[model samples]
Target: MAKLKEKKALMIIAERNFRDEELLEPKKILEDREIKVTIASTSLQNSRGMLGATVKPDLLLSSVKVQDYDVIIFVGGGGASQYWNDPLAHSIAQKAVQKDKILGAICIAPVTLANAGVLSGKKATVFSSEISKLEAKGAIYTGKPVQVEGKIITGEGPQSAEQFGEAIVKVLENLPE
Candidate 1:
């Protein structure tokens, strides 16, 4: 077997409130494999999760340069809507795709990618409430527990958090060194 290259992932969470499991589960999976994970948000302060998990961001989103990581994941919650039309979030998503980096989004977080124009013609899944929004952005809605199209992965909601993380790890593991 070939040795896997060291991998790093950037996880973006809403500054105020994000879904706890959606961020934690995937982060744990990546770390378990020795993949470095950096938590980032709009601010450097502690961001609170819906279920009370407080995470201090390692970096501000504005400081992120797409070339620094192999994967970029956007964690979702009601607060994730804050990035739906955010230009910085959109720019980051666009740059991730341009760099062929793995992109992951769960729940409504996919909306941010959609608005970034990266989801067009890609098969994706999102929380039910944002299905039409995703479709409107030209994404083919799969409605699956987890959807992986190319390097982009999307999950429906909190219930699929574990599966979502596993999917990301699987994709990362398969990448060429």
Candidate 2:
């Protein structure tokens, strides 16, 4: 708890149509716990959510340095699919794992982690529609609202955002320094 006050988290969102709750809920919970949050996107311009929320990203996704943050999260929506095959996004996910940072994805965004090859053999959950794709990537789909495997967390959808946030917080609280 003492060290969590200085924890930092990087949240990646689609430049358009990121799920509102998926991004907002977890962010609020993390902030409430004193975790610093930074927003990144493919485009730095204001990004809009599917439900009409908007965010001005603090940095370009391409400009991100994985080592700067203790946690990395991918917010999901129809637009999150844009990252599913993106090489940079995949590299970020891989680096997060290699660096021992907490990593997360909500809704369809978990597909990006799956595609990045980090989700293989990990227990995860994602938006219902992408179940087969996640399974194809060698992930064990738990069908839970939120699944936490080691330092990786996956949320089923918008409804699971709070649980997803709490899961990350719980892990951070228990993380070995």
Candidate 3:
């Protein structure tokens, strides 16, 4: 018998205008299952969501050590586009793939992963407005609400946030500790 490693998830949100459901739904799901969930943002200030929800991030995105979590999710909203061209965010996304961790993105946040080059050659989904962005990065865009390719999980939009979280949990549970 051995002690199973506790799972941890890191969710990155924009400093402002992150989709409320995309971050909250998945966080509740993971925490309900006793998995640790941490929040990171472009800054340490409280982040406000598009629909008026507010969240206080636990850490600065630049300080994240990707290896600390079993999963890393990029939560989407219009502000998420900030990360789409960010080298720091790109590096984090790339490192997650290199480490074989479960990487997730919801709504337009998938564009960040797509821009990072991690979604290249992977089947993924994103908000309809950003489907072309994913395709431009070599991702096969699946028009589904949620699509998982290997360890990469992508959700179409707020409507699929819960399913996206469930998908991440499924992959996390099935992986070697």
**Best-performing candidate as measured by TM-score:** 2
Q: Candidate 2, which ten residues in sequence have the lowest lDDT sum?
A: 1-10
TM-score of 3: 0.96
For residue 135, what is the lDDT in candidate 2? 98
Model 3, 70-169: lDDT tens digits are: 8999999889999999999999999999998889999999999989999888899999988889999999998999998989999999999999999988
List TM-score per model, in order. Answer: 0.97, 0.98, 0.96
The best-first sequence of candidates by lDDT reads: 2, 1, 3
Model 2 residue 28 CA deviation (Å) reads 0.5
Worst 10 residues of 1 by lDDT: 1-10
Better of 2 and 3 by TM-score: 2
User: For model 2, which pairs clash?
Assistant: none
| Alpha carbon lDDT at 114, candidate 1 | 94
Model 1 lDDT tens row, 38-150: 99998898899999999999999999999999899999998999999999999999999999999999999999999999999999999999999999999999999999999
Q: What is the C-alpha RMSD of each candidate to the true structure, in Å?
A: 1.2, 0.8, 1.8
**lDDT tens digits, residue span 1-177, model 2:** 438889999999999999999999999999999899999999989999999998999999999999999999999998999999999999999999999999999999999999999999999999999999999999999999999999999999998999999999999999876
Give residue 113's error in model 3 in angstroms.
Answer: 0.8
Instruction: For residue 69, give model 3's deviation from the true position in Å.
Output: 0.8
CA lDDT scores, all candidates in order: 0.93, 0.96, 0.91
Instruction: Give the better candidate number (1 or 3) by TM-score.
Output: 1
